[model samples]
Target: MIKEANTTFPIHPLIKSRWSPRVFADTPVSDEAIYTLFEAARWAASSMNEQPWRFIYAKRESDAYKIILKHLAEFNQQWVKNAPVIILTAYKEKFNSGKENFHALHDLGLAMGNLSLQAQSMGLAVHHMAGLDWKKLQEIFNVQEGFHITTAVAVGYYGGDPSVLPEDLEESERAPRKRLPLNTLACEGKWIEQ
Candidate 1:
């Protein structure tokens, strides 16, 4: 289940080991470990130190857990059942100055990146998904207008059989990870085609 990245150049082992998995063991994650992951996110760099990122999480046994799960798209709901922890990431829409925080989503992504790496370091798996009912999330979590639900995360230990996943996901779970080459992704004052 360890799908180490096949990086062309040397990269940190923790980065290489991080991936989104659909299959998760049903074992419960420790509360302390969850706090550690969020703690790492709490320190991520943000625009003007706005730190707009916020998280709402629920352990499998909590009532809020089902409320969070109900917001997921059916495809995610299927495999997400195996995860012991569910979390939703949200970001503030504007700064206290009444100015729009254009970088809110970007900063939230940075926080999630930090959290994901921290989870990987702790031998835990994190699967982030954009497939969910935003409206339902707002209603269930009582999210205010200024706060937007960004992504849902499933977290747990890695120990589920690929066969248990849906056909397409099963294949995807076993397939090699792919990413565009740096030349195609970065450029010196000009964009380049892959």
Candidate 2:
């Protein structure tokens, strides 16, 4: 069920093909593939090489998976429950020198981008979700003082019945992918309101 993006300009096939899907097959992603995804993330460029991104991942049926699922917003839990893998992402608030790293979130985004592309290349789907209890996760995991929980992700092989989703979600699942035009997104030398 590949919903390849209908791009106005040519782009990398992987970029064009990647889209977050709520529906995921029950097939489990292999351990090696999971590690490979992280390996791709590990190489993402970071601010001052701080590499603040940190991830805690769990396969379906694991105790950690249940704990994560329990914290997700009800809406997310409804769909995410079918995913074979779940991951929590966090970033360090400060560098080793105790200085604030304001770009930590941006760096974490870069890492996630790398991971998503890798997953796409391997015929896997990645869905990032912000609807979670991050503060609770921080306490539950006993994360270090400077580390802040950011987002959660669902990963698994694509191909699940959209009919299983709620009416609104099922419509969304089957709808054509859409994005803002490039002109609205990028501007030349200066900022111009579209």
TM-score of each: 0.95, 0.97
Q: What is the lDDT of candidate 1?
A: 0.90
Candidate 1 on 76-146: residue-level lDDT in tens?
89888878999999999899898999999999999999999999888899999999997788887799889
Candidate 2 TM-score, true structure as reference: 0.97
When summed lDDT is taken over every stretch of 10 residues in candidate 1, the lowest stretch is 19-28
lDDT of 2 by residue, 1-194 (tens): 77999998999999999999999987999999999999999999999999999999999979999999999999999999989999899999998899999899999999999999999999899999999999998899899899999999999998888899999999899899998888888888978686
**The best candidate in terms of lDDT:** 2
Model 1 residue 169 distance off true place after TM-score fit, in angstroms = 1.8
Q: Which lDDT value does model 2 have at 53?
A: 97
Candidate 2, residue 189: lDDT? 98
lDDT of 1 at 87: 91
- Tell me the deviation in Å of residue 20 in model 2: 0.5
What are the RMSD figures for all models against the true structure?
A: 1.3, 0.9
Q: What C-alpha lDDT values do all the predictions have?
A: 0.90, 0.94
Q: Following a full C-alpha superposition, what root-mean-square deviation does model 2 have from the true structure?
A: 0.9
Instruction: State the lDDT at 163 in candidate 2.
Output: 91
